[model samples]
Target: MKAFTTLRTTAAPLIDGGKLMANVDTDMIIPKQFLKTTERVGLSEGLFHELKTLADGSPNPDFVLNKPAYKSAGVLIAGDNFGCGSSREHAPWALLDQGITCVIAPSFADIFYNNCGNNGILALTLPQEACDVLAGQAGGGNSVFEIDLERQLVIGPDGAEHHFDYDEGRKEKLLKGLDNIGLSLQQDSAISSFEAQRKLATPWLEKA
Candidate 1:
């Protein structure tokens, strides 16, 4: 996990609503069967194809990102309550694998938002109208966006900006790349010291 202070990058518009998965469950994105594979390439080759495509193999163009503007969208400007659905960590992994580092939306599902932060993805929530404006800009010929996680601002190409807020603890975790497991590991020294003290006080407490 790395801290997120700011990110300025090009925008690829994914305009479809209600179909795009956010903070998706990892299992659904890449089943266990594909988990152990050594290669990290082609993760996006079938990403959402099964859910958003047809049997004959043609793309479900109706899907938000099937359009040309969104072909390789790296920053998703999404809709209200984005990332709402089943709780799955794989969802964020799939998005990250596809090169999306940040998501700007009006709102997000709690689990999905947290999963994204844990994986170093900046999930931002703003006013619905603000998101709409950003989405529109992304659709128009290679738009650029600058997101300063530390300052909590999303700057658009035309110079307009939107501000957002997040939980301080989660922000710090993302900044340091510390997930729950990582956070616990950070306490190793203290935990060890506590165990040593307990052993001195109660030697019999140790397993025989």
Candidate 2:
């Protein structure tokens, strides 16, 4: 998980990316069959699998992801309550594998937000009006966006900026590429000292 600083892209605008899209649960992002593998690398194959493909396994030309403009999209401006349903860390993994680093939406499922932090994905929350504006811009397919996590700002194609809010600690963790395990490990020395004292006080515990 690399540190997330900024996402600058001049690629096609990410229009219709669920601005009206609702209830995009974990299963909708990646189907159950894709869950068979613990490895994250190949999960992109299943990202929006149902929407991106037909029952015959052919690419759905009408889907947003299959469109040529979004083929290389890095930032996803999404709709309200975007990541709903099951708590699957694989959801963000699949998105990242598909080259999407950030997902900005009106709201998100709580568990999904936590999973994103753990895996180095940026899940941004903004007002619905702001998201609608971004969606309109992206729908045009010619807009660009610069997402600066360090500054907590989204620079639109028109040079207008939208400020967002997030926990200061979580922001630092993303900027420093620190997951929960990494955050915990920061206290390794203190934890080790406590363990050493515990062993001294209860020698039989160490024997076990």
Candidate 3:
């Protein structure tokens, strides 16, 4: 897991992810064609692929991500129920590959939210009103936004801040860069002790 504390980045409005478009699934995020390979490389090119390019593979100048200002965007401001389809964790992987470290939305799909936590992406939920404001401001020249995990606040490019809440367990794991395995490893001594006791109790089952 990547340690998360404070991050400041240029934001890109996730205009078509699941809102403007009809149900953006994991395939849309990474596309089915790109799913065969397990390697993380080349995943960035798949992020918003359908919208970013044409059938002939030329760039769509009108898309938010295709624009110069948003090319390096690390934060995405999206609409409600973002990541609504498919439980594949590939969606977050694609976003991370493209340098999107934070996603601000009114809501998110359950599995996608957990996947993001496992993979070190910040999924921040704000009211629809707040999302609207952030989306509108994100395309401007500065497009900068700051996310502070410790303070649980999102600082807008204009310097105004909005507070957010997250589960305490997840928060601790993120702050410490712990994924599921890492979390379990934190109780290594306990697990080892339990295993030792179990082996002793079932001695007959042990292999020579």
Show where candidate 1 strays beyond 4 Å: 17-43, 50-52, 60-72
Each candidate structure's TM-score, on Cα atoms with residue i matched to residue i, is 0.79, 0.92, 0.92
Best by lDDT: 3
For residues 68-185, write the lDDT of model 1, one tens digit per residue.
Answer: 7566666877666767666666667777777777988777888888889888898888887787777777754477788887777899999987889988898888778788889899
Model 1 pairs in collision: 1-177, 2-175, 3-175, 24-91, 25-88, 25-90, 26-90
Candidate 2 local lDDT, residue 178: 93
TM-score of 2: 0.92
Question: How high is the lDDT of residue 147 in model 2?
Answer: 92
> What local lDDT does model 1 show for residue 62?
67
Off by over 4 Å in 3: 16-23
Candidates ranked, most accurate by TM-score first: 3, 2, 1
lDDT of each: 0.72, 0.84, 0.84
Q: What does candidate 1 score in Cα RMSD to the true structure?
A: 3.8
Q: Rank the candidates by lDDT, best first.
A: 3, 2, 1
lDDT of 3: 0.84
Candidate 2 lDDT, 1-208, residue by residue in tens = 7899998864333334444575678898898889988998999999989888988989998877888777787887767787899988889999989988888888999999889888898899889898888777776455678999988999988889999998999999999999988999999999999999999999998777
